[model samples]
Target chain A: MRNLLILIAKYGSTLLFLFLELVCFFLIINFNKSQGEIFLHSANLLSGKVNQQTQKISDFLRLEAENDSLLTENARLLETIINFRIHDQENNFEAFENKDSLAIYKFIPARICNKTTHLRNNYITLCSGKNDSIIEGMGVISNTGIVGIVNNVTDNYAQAITILHSQSRISAALKSSQYHGTLIWEGSEANKLSLITLPKYAEISVGDTIVTSGYSTVFPAGVPVGKVLNYSIDGGGDNYKVEVELFNNLNKLSYVYVINFPEKEEKEQVEISDGN
Target chain B: MGTKWIGLIIRLLIVVFLQVVICKRINLDYGILSFAHIFIYPVWIMIAPTKIPRPLLITIAFFIGLFVDMFYDSPGVHAAASVFSAYARSMILRFLEPDIGYDTDHPFNLNKVGILWFISYCGVFLLAHLFFYYSVEAFSFVFFYEIIMSTIISLLFSVFIMLIFILLSNPKY
Candidate 1:
């Protein structure tokens, strides 16, 4: 009895160490993904608040760049408006109400509360949520290019799954050829993405522009995704993994627009009707 | 004794603040890898008075790592590594046991122990901790290269700042 007690006393610390390590490993192996997500979302509440405060301070230092982006956005908006006005003047004002009813896209402007581009499953939190009509699964984009898709929403905060995240796949195509493929981030460089699922015979070359295919309604067609850097054939030569350099400087982005498709539900409903 | 607790608390706060607020933001990315996070949290466990009981020391070490894990958004990784280092600490002390044994409570003090001894001791412990950390994060033997690369880079980066921090503090036991 005494020997057993002595043994327990002598090695108790080692036993405790092993026990705690076991618990931690269990958490790592079992809780690494889903459970960690819940904890992270809750932690986001605190981190989001901290990021907002620091973002304000950093925002002050970045006023010049912000002005430049805003100016550029304004000019682009003006050019499109001028193009529309010219077309309307040549045609008629009789169909103006019909054109208004056909308008499908709305943009919700929001500042990024917190964003991380360096992690495997990166997420960006926008400062607007349900209150601003920003719902789950809406696409987000910067003035420069596509940013991400909104995945979760709180009352006043929405978590976006950034393009830099692992498991992030978006439909994209060649701007010139319309050869559609999947754009994926390989958990590495924030500026680079891999466009895969391209057929073996697809004519592709460096610097070729890529854009959203609009196969689904997530993004409008011809929204510039990236420019091809290079490509290589797979071992079987059935497909190619083309490297693309994204236009959005993800690390420096502050303002983004969450996209709403007013006709998405109607489109889905129509697509689901019984075959004719 | 009260002063000792207060000093420990202050150092704890300093380490946590530097890690979460400052070091987390300093990403020296050359390419895909950004490897410039300086980990000063090991000093929290290292600075405990040598007279503290082994079980309690390990418990404290686990919690310290758990605290760091919370900030890093990587649960289990830091805590596992910290406990491993804590469990190995007594053996390390015994291996380097002096002719008269570790007599002073202030074993981490650089003034008491010479610079060489302090550096080598911290170096070994931090290496073990970093190796355990990167391995856990890599999560598989398939990423052996990544584990080794991160371990070596983080160890060198952290040890430099840790030595500087220790010199500046010049703690009294």
Candidate 2:
């Protein structure tokens, strides 16, 4: 105890200096707005760099699995192209009937740099941004299901608001019944979403598949979303509220595709004029 | 000894007033570029009597910086920088110790120390204080370019003003 006291006496000033500096930093971050944001942003950027390095090693190990998924996706794309060509020949006989249905969507591949699934409003950061032609409001999807919508973009990074967010509402429909509804998150489960506005009369079962309705210019039609888990009628009794189990495991996502629609501006303009 | 303490307190009050009231208003702007800020408040910490206990000196430095921060609308940035410089003061003193060594009885002043030693001593502490102040204000090393630019420009102006103040006052604590 005597030696301990001597050490304290010798180093008390240094200890006090460090403690007070810590207090100052705490106060600085808590009290100031811009400083706090800068601190958090820098911290995120630093962590992103570290995550990128680790992801590279893990990605190398999972190359075979990743190649298999890519091969499957390529085969699906080839089938889609062949089907489109067949439809084009049929369209020649029925020209101008399906001109608007031919909305072209380009897919840009990106790797997830950072993501959060547990937050009330979770966000995913992509490694590709303006350089890769990504912009705000673009739909992001995995091979399994829908992922998110691009919220903001920087030079080399883009932030996306996932379907797990409270404010996220995507236009979805039942594959069998063809009834449309709004997919929303209830801020609890990460993998479950609520599909509202579906009419009670629509034939819905537990195993019915849900897919994007393509009402908006963000996503193309018939993209896989989830499967209906269960459903209930609200107090109004006019609509069915469905609980959907997402196809993609958001927690294990690594790669995603951002859909770039060329006709988005034209569609938006037409809608704005129709609104007037 | 008691009179010396009173004199020191009075000097501190005057320095704080000059910093908050006068120096704060002097904007160094050239068209669109406003590069420099006059930070004469650190002069008090730079010239404080070496005989004072280190912990007490650092604590006093914190409150003085907090007081200045109140006027600047920054909560703890100045206080942090002040504490850092005050804590670093002893090491600087030890590094610059002459063959005869420092007379801890008197505060550092142009009248007590020669021009070369005084300038070097104040210059080192002022650099530490300003760099730390800017770093805490920015709160990120990502704006390292802006931090370095502001530090160099502000350091030049602050040192010039400090030399003029010391020459005129010729203070001896």
Q: Each prediction's Cα lDDT score?
A: 0.80, 0.85
Best by lDDT: 2
In model 1, which runs have C-alpha deviations exceeding 4 angstroms?
A: A1-4, A34-276, B31-33, B98-100
Error of 1 at B38 (Å): 1.7
Model 1 lDDT vs. the true structure? 0.80
Question: Interface RMSD of every candidate?
Answer: 4.7, 0.8
Query: Given candidate 1, what's the lDDT at residue B139?
Result: 66
TM-score attained by model 2? 0.51
Q: What fraction of the correct interface contacts does each predicted structure contain?
A: 0.66, 0.74
lDDT of 1 by residue, B1-173 (tens): 88888997898889878888888777888753565457788877776677778898888888888888888887788889889888888887778766765657667767667888877788888888888987777665667887787777877888888888888887787
State the lDDT of candidate 1 residue by residue for A157-275, as single tens digits: 99999999887889999988889999999977999999999887888999999988877767766778789999999777899999999988999998788778777888777777944
lDDT of 2: 0.85
On DockQ, the candidate that comes out on top is: 2
